[model samples]
Target: MSQSASQVYGAVQALTQSSDTLFLLLGAIMVFLMHSGFAFLELGTVRKKNQVNALVKILADFGVSAVAYFFIGYQIAYGNNFFVGAETLAQGNGYELVKFFFLLTFAAAIPAIVSGGIAERARFYPILIATFFTVGFVYPLFEGMIWNNNYGVQTWLETHFGYGFHDFAGSVVVHGVGGWIALVAVKYLGMRKGRVRAGKHTNFAPSNIPFLALGAWILCVGWFGFNVMSAQAINGISGLVAINSLMAMVGGILVSLFAGKNDPGFIHNGPLAGLVAICAGSDIMHPIGALITGGIAGAIFVYLFTYLQNKTKIDDVLGVWPLHGVCGAWGGIAAGIFGQTSLGGLGGVSLVVQVGGTVLGIVIAVLGSIVVYGVIEKCSGLRLSEEDEFNGADLSIHKISAINED
Candidate 1:
């Protein structure tokens, strides 16, 4: 057996594929754990009565998202499908299937982000329908455009702007799309009942700080997988992405600590803002550039979150719009700036193309969300019945509380 060159080559190839499959599987599991982060984060932010609903929505939406992306979204984004026999599907250690698993987590995250904004008052099933439409249809189009270069978008960008838009881990594709879609859903749902009375806003503080912090920590840890594993192959993994992600996360924390004046909520969310922003550029950005990008994202979250709550009637429950939407957009643009060679990055980025691509994702998200959410509202209704809202999502929807009195 050792005498055959062909046998040795095949053995080596098989080993490489197996190793890569294992790497991506681990990454998928880590990102999968972030769903729990989403659940706990929403649970701690909403009123206590809505805690059960928060947990339920994350789990339920994940199920729906998995089905949607597997059957529909993956094909739409990457133009691949699972319409083959089991033997054919299992080829190459089932790497394609595992890829589907990893990317499904990202697709599912869009709905999770939206879940945060529309929590408390939304009807459960309609929200599921929204997730189906988004993960299955809307998000995939833009994902294909930038990531897969569908529609010649990257080619066109290169022809005109000298570089294709770069989003290493989907600052614009995932977070931007999710955040803007949440904005539309929030707009359609309107403020939680009596969020503002007599032109004065009423603030509802987070229900449990410990849970919120725990959620933040989980997401922070899981994000390393999110960024590093984007390479999809172990050989492609880079220490730069890891270090950049770290710098950005702390950058966000330090900036939010100062800008938010030590507010617990802002402090907890600060790292998320940075992480979200750095996702686009983590591969190419220097650590210092990542820190600035992340720090700015933190400031954006704190400032815009406060402004939206106080200066406007937009009742985004967890400030998803600022944390994801605005910060994600900032990350997209920041990548263009910081990815320049002069800035200690790998370069080959164009700022104008970055803005254009980011805007494209936003426009698609906003329009798609409006139609999808609007149709859902017209048919099944989007919000809970007033009685249900007053009683809270837990008792009204789930028929129990997070804590039970036996």
Candidate 2:
């Protein structure tokens, strides 16, 4: 090759490599902080009796996902194969590190999402076991199918339809997966003690709103990495992703502020709704499109949370389904609608296909988790005893009490 041509090639390669490395590092750090978000969010929602259990589950999830992702999750999700001929695992150097770090964030998110459903009642050891299977096998398998360039959903989409199923970020893959698991967990664990009785109603308010707000803020900040870094190429699109994410978040806040009739919980959940709504299309959406999408997401979350909690009686303590699952579906569909090549040269997909993919993801995640949790419940018992639950899982499972009457 000519010297000038070689120089251009070398420069392009270096820039690509640098972008990948920088985004990977930044994304990993941001995602790690989301654990703090989970901790405080769960702690704020559950009663004080279960505070320690919430803390332990969040901390353990971070640690467990780290180890599990390092050993197997990475290989399964981003590895070249299901079991063998995995190039990322072969040398364990170069781009492998980037892939590893990226997958770690995803793995960590799974258990954190489910913690909301099983809050205040599940046995600690069983929760840990569920996290193990989730990160180690279930998440990896689905993630690999969607993300791994050669052998998963991308390949399938390419072969069948000329364009691939584009997630831009991981609305269905990560958030959707986690939300489904949470639903299943709640079903298996049943409602908190005295939450429902002979068709009567009861109120279970959050223990601390400040903590919930703090967690929500952390999640909003970390989402920058979660969405922008997923570009996997951190040049122009990365900046666009960041802008879209912020726009959506702001829109969500504004919409919720108005829609909530000045309710703090609705306002606090707005940014989360926005974050979920933009995850699938952040890289592709115009600023206006993002803003609208986020605003709608925030409004929807406010309504859904009330509807689910009050009417349906699905006690999602942290509103994971509304914030993550429902808005995730919105984001996925928005990718198909608002996405435009003319805006930024990012081609849009068919709305039909996008909706199909989104629905498929939700169904699989919900049903799969239900089956898995059902088996676990039958085999080892998932819920704590009534006495233990009433007293609190913190003291029952960990032998630690949050109350100190002294």
Provide the lowest-lDDT 10-residue window in model 1: 1-10
Residue 150, candidate 1: how far off, in angstroms?
Answer: 1.0
Prediction-by-prediction clash tally: 0, 1
RMSD of each: 1.2, 3.3
For residue 323, model 1's alpha carbon misses the true position, in angstroms, by 0.4
What lDDT would candidate 2 get against the real structure?
A: 0.80
Which tens-of-lDDT digit does each residue in 149-220 have in candidate 2?
535566666667666666878888888878877887877777777877778757588888898898888988
* Residue 260 C-alpha lDDT in model 1: 100
Candidate 1 local lDDT, 104-168, one digit each (tens): 99999999999999989999999999999999999999999999999999999999989999999
- In model 2, which range of ten residues has the least summed lDDT? 88-97
Measure candidate 1: CA RMSD: 1.2
Against the reference, the lDDT scores of all candidates come to 0.95, 0.80
Highest-scoring model, lDDT: 1
